[model samples]
Target: MNRNVILTCAVTGAGDTTGKNPNVPVTPRQIADSCIEAARAGASVAHIHVRDPETGGISHSTDHFREVMERVREADTDIVMNITAGGGGDWTPDSEDPTRGGPGTDIQTPAERHEPVGELLPELCTLDCGSLNFSDMVYINTAEWLREHARLVQQAGVKPELECFDLGHVWFARQLQQEGLIDGDPLYQLCLGIPWGAEADTETMLAMRNKLPDNADWAAFGIGRHQMPMVAQAMLLGGHARVGLEDNLMLKKGVMATNGQLVEKAGGIIENLGGRVMTPAETRERLKLRDPSTGKIVGGEA
Candidate 1:
């Protein structure tokens, strides 16, 4: 098992989850506050996604991103900022015509999807490795799109965390690395327990983790009820952990959880297991992330 672990708290997600839990942050101020709380609660990174404040819908507005970044960056506490570059891929077949995209469709060109990450130049941004049957919709990220997206992220000098939803995604991620599309050692996030994705279980995680490159830095999370259990499982297997409302809405059976609460709970699990929850500084060094303030890539391999 890894003695030192980095915990990431995904504050909000591009889902219809805002109505499911009252604690899900919608406004920029709220999202920033939640991220700060997670950092204070021992999260090394805050994985962020913005939503339309009034409608609680997923948004790709750079204005929303700007506000959230300004607040989080100017905050007193230190937390590695990770923005979603995986937006605008949600696709559903139109009811009237199956060939056409439906009302929920939010597809963006690779250039459009990379706009926020390109402008903000965050320490980290998501690089979804492949598409998946995300619930009833297909989150489309073609190989061509991913390769193009990787080039853009590399140009910005930002780290791209390969978000693998299944075994094939891991394969594609490795291919990206082999092609030198992703700079440095590839960082990975094994997204588990989403409907039609990899199962949130030990065997499945191990299978995915086994495919990672030798120098890979990886973290894993389970959605909904398996959130906490997967934390222990990942830690026991020497991998990092991720938690927050993006993947889970409840603290217990019927209790809604705040972002800080989830981070706190995950932190407790790590400490109780005699493991160290890494600080943001350590996380940067471990992940070889460039400092936004100093604009230099710290020298290390996680």
Candidate 2:
């Protein structure tokens, strides 16, 4: 184990979980409040994905992101803000046309998907490595599109957390690193146990972790019931962990949970494994993020 493990809390995802858990925050204020609560519970980073307020579905509107960022920034919280740049990639095939997009399709250009990151300029944002059959639909992130997104994120001076769902995606991330598209020590987030992605198990996590660049800063997460188990696994394997209402809503079987409860549980797991939980400031330094105002790391440090 690395001894110092970072815990990230994903407050609310853009998934269709509104009916499953009533506590998932929809509005910006509610989302910011949940992020604050998670930070209080020992999460050094907050992985955020905004949603459509009225419809309670996923949204990629820059305004929605702006609202959430404004609220979180104005608060006194010290959690590192990690906004999602992985949205606007869903593609549902047309039932009638078959070759074209259907009613639920939301495919977009790389620039469109990254507009919020360019505008908000957060310390960190995600870059999904490749497209996959995400459940019944495809998450369309072609290599060209990914390269474009990576270039834009690097140009904007925001760190990209390469989100790898499977082994092949990890390979692609490495390709990007080799091409010099992704600078500095890369950051990766291993996403496990989605419908068509990698399974949530020690073997799968280890395989992906082994493929990462030696100098990379990485974290792993598992969905639903596998969430907490992955937390312990990541820490024991010398990696960071992520958890929150976005990934798992149940604290126990048949019991719903809040974001704070999830963060607290993950923190407990890290502490029990003889790992020190990182604060937001520590994570920022480790990831090499410059303070927005000074154009240097906060505190003249890092």
Model 2's number of clashes is: 0
Output the TM-score of candidate 1.
0.98
Q: Which parts of model 1 are misplaced by more than 4 Å?
A: 300-302
Candidate 2 local lDDT, 82-102, one digit each (tens): 999999899998999989999
| Cα-based TM-score, every candidate | 0.98, 0.97
Q: Over 4 Å off in model 2, which ranges? A: 298-302
| lDDT (10s digit) by residue, model 1, range 31-145 | 9999999999989999999999899889998889889999988999999999999999999999999999998999999999999999998999999999999989999999999
Q: What does the lDDT read for residue 186 in candidate 1?
A: 84
TM-score winner among the candidates?
1
Error of 1 at 292 (Å): 2.0
**Count of residue pairs whose backbone atoms collide, per candidate:** 0, 0
* Number of the top-ranking candidate, with lDDT as the measure: 1
